[model samples]
Target: MTNNQPAPDGVLRLINGYWATGVIGAASAHSLFTHLENGADTAAKLAARAEISERGTQTLLDGLVGVGLVQLHEGRYRNGPEASAYLVEGKPASLTSFAQLKLKHMGGLVALPDVVRAGGPVTDPTTEVADNPHWEEVVPAIAAQSVPAATLAAEVLGLAGAGPISILDVGGGSGIYSAVWLEANPQARATQLDWAPINAIARRLLVERGVADRFTSVDGDFHTTDFGTAQYDVALYSHIAHQEGPENNIAVLARLRQALRPGGALVICDYVVDDDRGGPAFPLIFAAEMLLKSKQGGTWRRCDYHDWLLKAGFEDVSFHSAPPATLVVAR
Candidate 1:
């Protein structure tokens, strides 16, 4: 042991990383952020309103402040800017459900070693687990998580005021992209293809967003469902490429290409690693999650997407940074 250098600060933070997730999730479940937003600033008041123990409330508040999700001022605690926006229960952009849903995934991660040993999950989540299906929860939660990526893709593609364009969102979990785009461009309409149950959820959410009248749901698996030819001005395959093997993605991309209008674009959003497979921490780490959850699922390189999209009959492919995700546009 050297006197000058003693502790492994970064390593320790990584080791105890679940603390951050646990505390934040617990706070969200307790409605702590919503309570703070509603002006229950003091520990006692928050505890009373949230039905938490006073000491428990104080400790949780302190943890939230430590994690930068809450701010402390003059012995009072309140939500930080992000918590104020996305952790509150009733907001459209709220990730409260997502946070709670991730708490369910944490326990499953304990089997990562077993999953790796077996070369994948003993039973893959991608295969549709009837005993413990997560996609129902996963779809909606993912919509909140995808707000930034979806919104960014819309802007990058000039969806706003792109008059009367039709969108085909294959595997469009919560139909968030459609909702976001339709809201931005009134003349736009969307068709979402997903499982019957998932499409129902998307339909309900779209109804809540007041855009269901212009949205259509096609209830079936994207792999088997017919995407139709040259029907859509824009085709979206977001956050799904990572869940598939190269061949599967390529096949789907080819179908997406055929579905687009003559001069239309196909937009793909995913966690794409650089060709060299170097760094960009989150996507690389996310590969491990995919590894444990599905067979043949992992983060792919830029070259992989380029090759796959081109092989799928797309002439030009370009990548764009959308923060925490990347977008590939093919035309």
Candidate 2:
């Protein structure tokens, strides 16, 4: 909404945002979209398919309509374009797992006040980064979200139809980059570095993508692990910087710089805010997410990235726009 809209409605939407979250979560939990994609066009059919009452089903459908994810015509409901593409179960970009996983993470937001007062997570930040148990459940869901970001990065580098190359994916959660880049170039081989359990999930993902033979995993924390020197033609550190302080980020970037070959590229993807921090709503809100979860993480700016990349010995740096994330490529 524009800033000139009604003040009360804006405040209400901000405060009652959980209503939308709950509506989306509940709809996904019941497989409403998947059923709608089938023959369940009417409320009765949907309720029967979902094992819920027709009255409740209609209410849920109305909520979905209000949220712009569903459309109703002549008493028949249908999934919207986005719903059909990304919310249906088993699609390549389905976010069903990620949406449900968020239902669990929303509980953490309840303690935001305490977290803010403490200036970080009320729980130990140590448990939240490298070894978080929730990583297994959340990483797969996160993989779907990475599809466009990884694909865009690969396109930006013109990886498709290119010759043989090696990829080093640091904290490569769902192994989406490996799958995308390897598919783009059949001669390419990729290695992922992440926690053992998360790497297990990524391995399964790559296996499903039919590129398992060319994919490998390194099980360790990126903060302590040796990235090795002049090894990778391309390195990806997607969505990891927001969980780290500046020094930690620079240290990791330096390691990744050393890990790259002479002309190698390192891709850093995250929700990067503008230098002025004036607008771009999602990244601004993401800073709070970092605040609620990490000891020193927030959405960094382009200047910050440029400075860090230069300090890390990257001679060239550039930025690219990717929705829900941005790419900072350095060499």
Candidate 3:
């Protein structure tokens, strides 16, 4: 053995200890960080509340403290600043919904090993999430979860042009994209389409946001439903394409094209891989998860959207960079 620890990559090879994800997952699952949502507690109290053995909880908390997700002081543990903001439930800027999404998908880590051996699409354990009644019930929370991203999309739509606009939001879970845009531009209205659970949530969210009067909800599967043709001034596809794959995306674009009035616009938001096939890290990692969970989805290239848009009968596609993903605007 040539002392592999110090192998050619030097510090780079040693620094990539693989247990980071597991440690974080363990911390989250145990609610070690979020349990401190109300206040700090001793390990004994936390373990009791979480219904785990105290010794195990203490050990896990120690690891979190080392990893900076938690802080240990005197004889108690608390969420660190970063965790407090994003991990705690009911916080103003909570990302716990996305974190839960991550946790729900963490089974992919183990599933990936089998996926590599089989060499094709892996069976998604989460496919049924779309069918769950709870999915409809939680759509508002999910839509609310998308507020930060939608706020940006709303700004883009505001800058595009002037009119009393009608927007069609396809696969509009949580209706964040439309809701945010409507909030920013009071003259704009939206038609939101998705599974019923999500539509239910979108209904309430639009009401709460004061746009329900202008909002219309269509609840059904996207594949068979009619998304009104030659009707709207703008259509939005946000984070929906990568879940279905290229062929479906092309078909969707074509359908939406028919839905747009002459010279109307289509806006797509998705992670774009560099044409050179290098790293953005987020899209690549997400592509791996798509392999494990989706049938036709992956992070695609920038050209893919442009080409697909053109092939689907759109012209003058424009691309803009948003962190971790790109916005594609076409007419």
lDDT of each: 0.87, 0.88, 0.74
Using Cα atoms with residue i matched to residue i, what is each candidate's TM-score against the true structure?
0.94, 0.94, 0.76
Q: Report the number of clashing residue pairs per model.
A: 0, 0, 5
Candidate structures ordered by TM-score, highest first: 2, 1, 3
lDDT, candidate 1, 179-277, per-residue tens: 998898999999999888788889988998889999999988899899999999999999889989999999999999999999899999999898898
The digit string of per-residue lDDT tens for model 3 on 17-136 reads 334455566666666667776664788888887888989887877767866878777877788898887667666456555544454555547777777666545564554465676574
- Predict model 3's lDDT versus the native: 0.74
**Model 3 spans > 4 angstroms off:** 1-85, 91-93, 121-130, 134-145, 159-163
Measured with C-alpha atoms, the lDDT of residue 159 in candidate 2 is 87
Query: Which stretches of candidate 2 lie above 4 Å from their native place?
Result: 1-7, 126-133
Report the C-alpha lDDT of model 2 over 197-307, residue by residue, as the tens digit.
889999998899899999999999889999999999999999999988999999999999999999999999999988998756789899889888778999998899999
Query: Can you list the residue pairs that collide in candidate 1?
Result: none
The candidate that wins on lDDT is 2
